[model samples]
Target chain A: MALTRRDILVGGVGLAGLTVSGCAGSPTTGGRPIPVQGATAPPGSPNLLVIFSDDHRADHLGITGEVPFLQTPALDTLASEGVRFDRAYVTTALCSPSRATLLTGQYASRHGVQNNLSAWTPGTPSFFDSLAAAGYRCAYIGKWHMPGDLPDLPGVERFVTFTIEEGQGVYRDCPLIVDGVQTPRPGTYVSTDLTDYALQWLEETDDGRPFCLVVAHKAVHHEFEPPDDLLGTYDDVAIDLPDEAFTYQTLLDRNVWEGTAGRLQTSYRRYCETLLGMDREIGRLLDAIEPVADNTVVVYTSDNGYSWGEHVLTGKRWAYDDNIKVPFIVRWPDGVTAPGTVSDAPVLNADIAPTLLDIAGVPIPAAMQGRSIAPLLRGEAIEWRDEVFYEYFADFPYQVPPSQAVRTDQWLYVEYDRGLAPELYDTVADPQQQVNLADDPAYAATRQELSQRLADLRREFT
Target chain B: MSAAAQSGAGAMPGEAARSGPVGSSSGRAWRIAAPAVISVVTFLAIDLLLAALVGRPWGPAYPLSMDALVLLRMGPVFFSGLIVWPVMRARGATRAQAVVGILATPLAFAIVSGWRAAAFFPPLEAAYYSTNPMVVGAIGSQVSSAGVGALVYALWRARRHRSGRPVSSGATPLPISTGWSWGPIVAIIAGTALTVFAVIWDGGQHLFYPWVLLYGSLFG
Candidate 1:
C-alpha cells in the first residue's frame, strides 16, 4: 500500500502518543528483559561507547591511507587497536535518517525518518530501550538534528543535545539541553564541550551496572568550523580534489545553495581541521575509558560521509561512495578476539544497534532488521552479507533526487526518481564511479540482476 | 502645465545638450545598458552585504538561518525596477525608454544570476528545478515584486504630473510622440532565447528530463 502524507503524520502522532504513555517498557518480565534467543546480561555487563561524528568521510582518516596528509592520530590509534570495516556504509546518506537507522537498527522507511524533516518515531524500539531494560545506564549526547523537537527517549537517562539554530548547533558556545534543562556554555567549542559532557558522565556514573553512551559530535558538519587552535592546521596542505570539480563549484555552492561563502580549497581545509579537532576530543574520551577498556566496547563512526567536490557535490544525501561510506572502527577487548583486523565484510549503520545489543548480551529485537556481527568480531566463521542496499529520500530545499542503490563487492547500481536515468558502475574497474554502465550491453545482465536484488532488498527491509 | 512640460521648459544648458532624441543608436544603447548595469550592481551589493552579515568572517561558517539569507537576497531583485527608475529619469529618457529600462532591470538580473546557478552539476540543477516549491516561490516573488514596483513608479509619475511639480533637477524630457521601435522588443526576445538555449545546452538532460516528467504529469 502506498503511504500518503496523511499516513506519515498520523503514524508520527500515534508513535508520539505511545512514547508519552511509556509503552516501551513491559511490566511482566520484571524489567530484566528476556533476549529473543538467549539470556540477558546480569548486573555487570560491558560498557558500550559509540563516538559518532558528522560528515567525516570514510577516506579522511590517517589509518585509511586514502588521504596521506590527513592527521587523525586518535582515530588511527583506535583503528590500530580495533577492527575497521573498510567498506562500511550508511543505508541513508542524510544525517537525520542515518542517525535514526543507527539507533533503530532499521531502514529509514521503517523508522519513519525518511528525510531530515521527519523525526524519530517516538515509540520505536531502539537498542537504548533494550540496554536500559537489561540493567544498563544509557545516555545520548550531542547533536540531534531530527525534526519534531528533541524526543524524550524512554531509555536515555540523560539527553544532552541542542535545539539552537534548528538543531544544527553552532560550532562555538553552543547551548546544551541537559536532562530537560537548558544550560549555556559560553566560549566553548561544540566537539570539545560534547566530549567533556561524555567524560563527566563516564566519571560520575559510579553504579556497578554497565553503561551505553552515544557521543554524537557536530564537528565536521557544514560551516566546518574547527576549534581556534586547530583552525589553520591544514591550510598549507594541498587539497586532492576529484577531477570532476569545477573551479567555482564550491563558491557557487556556498553562495547560492548553502547561503555561505568560500572556495573549495578553503572549505575543505576547514573540514579537515575540524575533523582534527574532533579527533583530539575522541582521544580524550579514549583515555577516559582506558581503565575500563578491557570490559568496554568502543565503536567509532560518522553519521554520513561528506563530499569535498567529488561529482561536483559538496554535501551528503547522494548514493555516491563519498556520501554513503563512513569510518567504522570497533575495539572491544573482551568481545573482539583479533585486534587490528580489517574486515572486508560490508556493514551498514543499521548494524551498529544490533551489534552493540549483541555485545552487551541483550536480546537483539525481532523487529530489528540488521544482523549482529558479534561472531565476526569474535573471529568465528560466520556467513555475512554480500551486498548492501542504500536509500535516500528527497529533502526539500536541497535538490538531490530521491535515489536507491545496491552496492556489492564488484558493482554499484543506482536508480533515481523524477525520470532521472539509472547509474551502474563496475566497482573493480571504476572505483571513482566516473562511468555509467546501465545502458552498456556487456553489463546488461549484471545490471538486471542488481536491479532485481535492489527491489528485493527494499521489499524485505521495509 | 504637466511635470514633463515644466522639466522641458526649465532645462539646464548642459542637460539640454545631453537630453537628445531617443532615435540615435548610441543614445538608445546607453539608455538600455545603464539600467541593466545598475540592476546588476544592486543585486551584487545586497548579496555581498548579506554574506558579510550572516557568514563567518574568519572561517567558512554560516551559523544563521539559510531561509532568511535566501529571502533577503530576493529583496533587490523584486524592487530592481524602482531602484533603476530614478537613474532612468535622471538620464532624461523618454517615457517609453524609461519603461523599457525598468522592465529590463529585473530581466537582466534574473538571467545573469540564473545562468550562474545553472552552472552547477547538471543533475543537481535538474533536481533543483524539478517542480521544486522553492524555485516556484522564488520565480513568483521576482515577477510579482517587479510588477508591483513598476506599478508604483507609474502611479507616482502620474501624481507628480497632475500636481504640476518638476520631477527632478530639470532636464528636457524627450517627446513621448517618438514612434515605438521593434529594436528593444527584438533585443529582449533575443536575449531571453539565448539564455534559455545556453542553460539547456549546459545542463543537457539534467535540466530537461525533470521538466519533461513534470509536464507529462501536469498536461497528459
Candidate 2:
C-alpha cells in the first residue's frame, strides 16, 4: 500500500479544499480576482496604497522624540517623502470604531461603531465602495477588524486578512485568509507576510484599472510579539523613560489608573522591536510599488495611537494626545505640491474616507461627516477646523471611563460622563495633561467657552 | 436487564448494590455539576458573541484579560445562583427543571443588563447597539448555552439508563401546563422591549418621540 505521487497530489488538493472551506464566508475576501492589467499605473489615474498600523504612537518614530535611539527607517523615509500631519487624531481612540471612522468618514456616533463591540451599519457608504463603483480595483490586505466576523467586503476586488484567534491576528505563524481561503500556517511575521501578499497582489492585479490596497499591520499592539530577527533589536538600548507625572502608579493613586507601571523599559523595548518589523514591512511595501511610484498615492498612518506610560496609561481610549494622536504621512506624488512638508491642520480618522474618495476622483458622499483634506494635501489654502472633539464609551476591558473632550490649539476641556472630575488644561503650558484647571477661577471663562463649544460640536457631530 | 438487575442484583460481591437510575457517584456529581458548568459555558459564549458582534478591540486571543468583558460576563455567572438555586429547589425538580433553571439566570441577567444599559449608558446604546448587536448576541448566546446544558443533562441521563441503574423515581418532566406558562411570554416581551430600547432608542428626544422623517415631510 505505497502512496503514489497521484495520491499525494489528491491529498494536497483535499487539504487545500478544506482550507478554502474554512474561509468561505470570511469578511476580508473581496470579489473575484482581477487579472493583472500591467506593471505600470492605469492611464490618468494614480493607485492608492494606504499602509495602516495598529496601536502605533505618533511620537514613537525616529523623527518623533519618544525613543531617541530607535530607528524607523521606512516610516522616516515615508515622512521625508511626503506630508506629515502633526495634529492628526482619532475621533474615538479605539480600534474598530476608529477604523470604521477611517473607512466611512464619519464620527463614531454617525457610523454607529462607537466601541469595539459595535458594528458598522452595512449600508453605510464607504470610500472604497465609491472607488470600486468608479471602476477602481479595491483590495484590502492585512487586519480587517470590522464586525460581522469580517464578512465579504463590498467593492473590494481582493481581500486578504488575518484569521488568528481574535481581535488583532497573531504575531507569528499567523492565519491568513487569502481570496476567501484560510492559508494554514502562513509562516512567520504578520507584517512581512502581509507585505509579501500585498506585493503579490500588486503583481497579479490587472493594472488596467486604478487600485486601492489597504496594507494594514498588526504590530505594536499588546503582547508586543516581534519576529525572531527583531526580538532583541532594542532590548539592550538605554531608553529615557517618562517622568513621575506619567507613572501608572500616579494614575492608580489618582484613581485614573490605566496601563502598566514598571514594565516601561521592557514594553518600550519590545514596542520598538515590533515597530522596526513594521517599518521594514513598509519599506518592502514601498519597494513593491516602486515601479508605479509616480502614479501611486502612498499613505501611512495608524488606526489609533498607543501610550507607552504616557499619563500612566498603557493603552488607548484616553482623550490625551498620546492616546489619540497618530503618525500620518502621505506621499501622493502627483497631488502633493511640496514634498516633506508638515501640516498642522487638525485632521481626524474620519477625514481619511473622504480624503481617499477625493484622491480617487470620486464624489464625496453626503453621508460622510468628514471634510476632505485633498486641498491640504496639495498645499492649498482652505478653511479648516480649529478644534477637534474626542469621545470614549466605557466598556469592560479598558476601564478609562467614558469622557468627552474638545482640544483647541491652546486649551483642552474634558467632561467625564462618569467617574472622576472634569479636567481643563492649557495644552500650550501643560502639554503633559498634568494640571487640572477645571475649577480654577482664572480659566472659568475659557472652560465655559470650551464646554459650550464641545457641546455644540457634539450636537453637530452626533 | 430487568428491574431487579437494575436495582443492583447484578452488582459485584463487595460492591454496594445500585439502587436508583443515577449510576456511579461520579454520575451523581455530574448531575449536580452540570448546571454550573453550563452556566459558565453559556456566559462565555455570550461574551464571545458580544465581542464578535461588536468587534473585539482586545480580540479573542486574550479573552480572560479583557477586564471589562470579564466583569460584564462574570456578573451574570456570579448572580446566576440566585435564580438557578431557587428554580432547582422548587417542587418537582427534575432534569428538565434543572436545565430551565440553569438558563433562567442568563435570561434575567440579559434583561437587567438591557435595562441598565438603557438607563445609564444611553449614549453607548444609541451609538453602538443601534443595529441591535447586543440584543441578538445576548439571546443567541443564552439559547446556545441552554442547548448545551440540556445536552449535558441528556447525555448524563442516557448514560445512567444505559448502565442499567434505576433512576431516582417520581421525578417527572416539566408539565405541559408549566411549560406554556404566561410568565415566560411576558418576560420575553418585556426583555425584548428593554433590549430594543437599550440598543436602538436614544435617551434624548428620541426617547420621548422616536418617529423621525426618513424622506422628509409628506408636504415636502
Best by TM-score: 1
Interface RMSD for each of the candidates: 13.4, 15.5
TM-score of model 1 (CA atoms): 0.71
Error (Å) of candidate 2 at residue A115 is: 0.9
- The digit string of per-residue lDDT tens for model 2 on A23-103 reads 544434432333233233235777888888999988888977557888899888888888999999889988788888888
Chain B TM-scores per candidate, in order, are 0.43, 0.34
lDDT at A324 for candidate 1? 92
The digit string of per-residue lDDT tens for model 1 on B1-220 reads 3333435764322233334444577864575457647666666765666545532223323323333454545555544544454445555666566555555544544454444334332444434343332233333343344344334444454455556743343222322223233433343444444334323332222333344345334432
Candidate 2 chain A: minimum summed lDDT over ten consecutive residues — where? A247-256
Alpha carbon lDDT at B109, candidate 2: 49
lDDT of model 1, residue A227: 88
Q: How far is candidate 2 from the true structure (C-alpha RMSD, Å)?
A: 14.4
- What TM-score, over all chains together, does every model reach? 0.71, 0.63
Over the full model, what C-alpha lDDT does candidate 1 score relative to the true structure? 0.68
Error of 1 at A164 (Å): 0.8
